[model samples]
Target: MTYPHDPIPDLSADRAELFAAAAAEYDRYRPGVPPEAAELLAETLRDLPDPTLLDLGTSTGQVPKALLKALPSLDYIEGVDLSQQMLDQARAALTPVLGGCTLSLVQTSAELYKPLAPLPEEEWWTPDLITCCRAYHWMSGPDVLARTHRIAAPQASLAIMGDGSLWMHEADWTRALRDLVQQFLGAGRRAGALGDCPKPVRPFQEELADSAWSDVAEHRFPVTRSWSPESVLGYLRTTSFAGADLFAERHAAFEEEARALLDNLADGGPLLEETAFTVLLARRRAGAR
Candidate 1:
C-alpha cells in the first residue's frame, strides 16, 4: 500500500535480521499482556466448535497463546509470520499453550501465503477463523483481504485487531519519537527499517467490504498495557524504524536517551499507560460472490 510519508528504502532482509537478533528480548520489550486481544480471541472462538484456525502475523504467537488457554479443543492452530526469528520464538513459547492441539508455524509473509481449498465434506480444518493482530497494516491493501477470503471457508470469520492509537497516549513521547524517526529516515536509512505510520480504519474497513466478505463490522474497545521504561525502549528497538541497520551507529545512544526520557516520565514507579484497540470483523460470504 502507498504510504503518505516519504518512501523509505526496502530493507525487509535487514529488518528480519534485526528482529532475529532481538527475538529473545521480545517479552522484555513489551511485557504487558494484551488483555483486549485476549478477550477478542476468546469472544470470537466462544461459540465456534473445534475448527481450523489461521493466525496471520503471529509474532511470538501472542494471540494464539491466549486463545489456546481459553479454548483447548481447537483442532489445529497455524501461525504465519515473515520473520523466522519471531516464528522460532513463538513456537518455543506456544508449545506448552498448544498442549495436545495441532500447531504449525510457517515462516512466510502473510500477504504471500495462499490458503488451499478445503477437502470435500471436511468442515473442521477449513480455517473457519482467521485473525490478524497488530500486523494487518503491513499488508498491501485489497490484495491481502482478497487472498484471505479465498482461503477462508464459507461462513468463516476474519478479525483484524490493532491498537489504533497505540503510541498516541503519551503525546509528548509520541511527537518526539515521530521526529526522531523522520530524522533517521531523512538520513537515507533503509525503507524496511522504518516502522509503519498509523493507518485510518476507514480504508481497511472499506477494503474488507469490497472483498469477498459480507456483514463487515468495525468495533473499538478500550484496553491498556503497562510497560517499564526499559521494556518500552526494548519494544521500540524491535520496530523496523529502530532496526540495527537503520541506526547502526546510533542505536545504543538512542536507547540510552529513550530510557532516560521514559524514566523521567514514569508515574507511581512504573511507566504505565492505557491505549485503545480497534477491531474489524467480517464474515465470508456463504458462497463465492
Candidate 2:
C-alpha cells in the first residue's frame, strides 16, 4: 500500500514511554473495555468465517483479550504499540487466552505500521476489524486513520472507544483529587515528556467526515466502577496526569494525602464512579476502496 503523506517522524515514542514506568501498575489497575462494547465489536465480526483483528495502542492488551474471549470466530490478531514494555505485558496477557487464534504484537506507532505481505497467490493481509481503545487520543488521528484504511479489508469495520478517566469524572472525591494534583504538579494535565496532553481539535465524528471510513455508528455503555482508597491511589500512579514521576520526591506524600482525602470522602464505602463508555464504529464508504 502506498501512503499519500510524507514519511513522518516516529511520534509514538513519547506516547509509548508515557506509561513505560507504570506498565505493570497500569495492567493491574486499569479497566478493560466493557463487555457490551466488546460485544458490539464482536457483532461486526460474527458474519465473517475467519475474522482478523488489529488493535492500535493495545496497552497491556486489554481490548484484544476481551474481544478474543467474546468472539470465537476471531482467527488472528495483531496488536501495535510503541512501548516495548507495554507490548511485553500485552503478549504475556494475550497469549494464554488466544486458544487456537494467532497473535502478533508489534512495537510501532499506528501511523508507521505496515502489514506484512501475504504469501504467493495470496492477497494482502488486511484485518477484518480494527480497534483503538483508550489510547486514540495520544495518536496522530488523520494519519493513523489513513493508514488504518489502507491495511483494513474492503468490508472491514473500525471501532474507536474510550471513556473519561477518574481525573476527568465529576464527583466530590475526584474533584478534590484533581485539585491536589494541580497543587503539586501545576494547572495543566501532565502527560510525561509531552507536558499536557492536547485534546483533539475536533471530535472523531467530525474528523471522520471526509475519510473513507465515513459510515459511522455510535454506541454508548453506562458503566459503574467502584474503587477503594488504596485502589484509587494505585490507579493514580498509573495515569499520566498524576503519575509518580510527576511527583518525584513527593510521590509518597501525595499518595498519603490522596488516600486520606479519598478515605474521608468514601466514609469506609467503595468510591463509586458512574461514567459512559463510548464506541464509534466506522466502515469504508461503499465503493470507496
Best model number under TM-score? 2
**Residue pairs that clash (backbone atoms under 3 angstroms), model 1:** 8-191, 9-191, 193-240
Worst 10 residues of 1 by lDDT: 1-10
> How do the residues 81-172 of candidate 1 rate in per-residue lDDT, one tens digit apiece?
76777877888888877777877776666767755334488543557788888777777757777787767777678888877432445666
Tens-digit per-residue lDDT, 168-234, candidate 2: 8999889998999999999998888889878678888887777888899899999999999988888
Q: What is the Å distance of residue 189 in model 2 from its true position?
A: 1.1
Off by over 4 Å in 2: 1-12, 117-123
* Clashing pairs in model 2, backbone N/Cα/C closer than 3 A: none
Each candidate: what lDDT? 0.67, 0.85
